[model samples]
Target: MTIIQFPTAPALNASEPHDLLLETLRAATNQLSQAGKALVQCDSEPAARVEAASHLVSAGQSIVAALNAYQRGLQHASDQAAG
Candidate 1:
């Protein structure tokens, strides 16, 4: 098994879940943009560019999880408002 290590940014610092969600979503957008550029620019070898883009896309997993949490938070808030 080969283990590849990619560069990682520092963890998000936020007191609230919404703050983390927003920060995560923003990071995901940046990663998606860079991934698109990687494929569009083709600055490196085809396989290398694909690999780099794949890593970038994978790095955005936190966004997916954060979005799920954010949706739940919204639903909870809405339920409270309704009651």
Candidate 2:
């Protein structure tokens, strides 16, 4: 029998989650912008163009949702720290 050991991720500190989320938000925004540009440059059929646009819109919606969640998490953390 062969035994394999995998390295485990280090535990996150208190502020890491917020930082990580912010980083993710930034990446998502960049991706959304790139997607928008691609949609604009796309010269495919009307249906295909519409589908690309729809995907860009969906990415925008995801960014909005993530921002909202991040804000709520920060507020909750602040409240907890204050009390």
Candidate 3:
């Protein structure tokens, strides 16, 4: 079975919200990758594989919501600052 890995980030401080989101997404991707690998490895009674797949789906959905909220928040903050 292949070992899945996370996405690499360029050198950046983690204090920024965008950076934090990117890091979060990278982690999610890594998790999804590992889950996929787990599915491939199982090939039998798929309970573990199904659970891992569920994890991937949940993480992906959460990431999408968080990122969207972050973007909207940033835009609102920007507009407030400008005004």
Q: What's the CA RMSD for each of the models?
A: 4.7, 11.1, 4.9
| Candidate 2 local Cα displacement, residue 76, angstroms | 0.9
How displaced is residue 30 in candidate 3, in Å?
1.0
Q: Clashing residue pairs, candidate 3? A: none
Ranking by lDDT: 1, 3, 2
Q: lDDT by residue for model 1 over 2-83, one digit each (tens)?
A: 2234445458896666987888777777666666666666654767576767867675676778889888888888898999
Clashes by residue pair, model 1: none
Q: Write the per-residue lDDT of candidate 3 for residues 1-83, one digit (tens) a residue.
A: 33334343344456656876787787767767877777777677456666667777866885896598679768987998999
Please estimate how well model 2 matches the true structure, expressed as its whole-model Cα lDDT.
Answer: 0.60
Candidate 1's displacement at residue 82, Å, is 12
**Tens-place lDDT digits, model 2, residues 1-83:** 21222122233233644775666566566666666665666665565566556666766676677678778888888999999
Q: Each prediction's TM-score against the native?
A: 0.61, 0.61, 0.69
Residue-level error in angstroms, candidate 3, position 73 = 3.0
Winner on lDDT (1 vs 2): 1
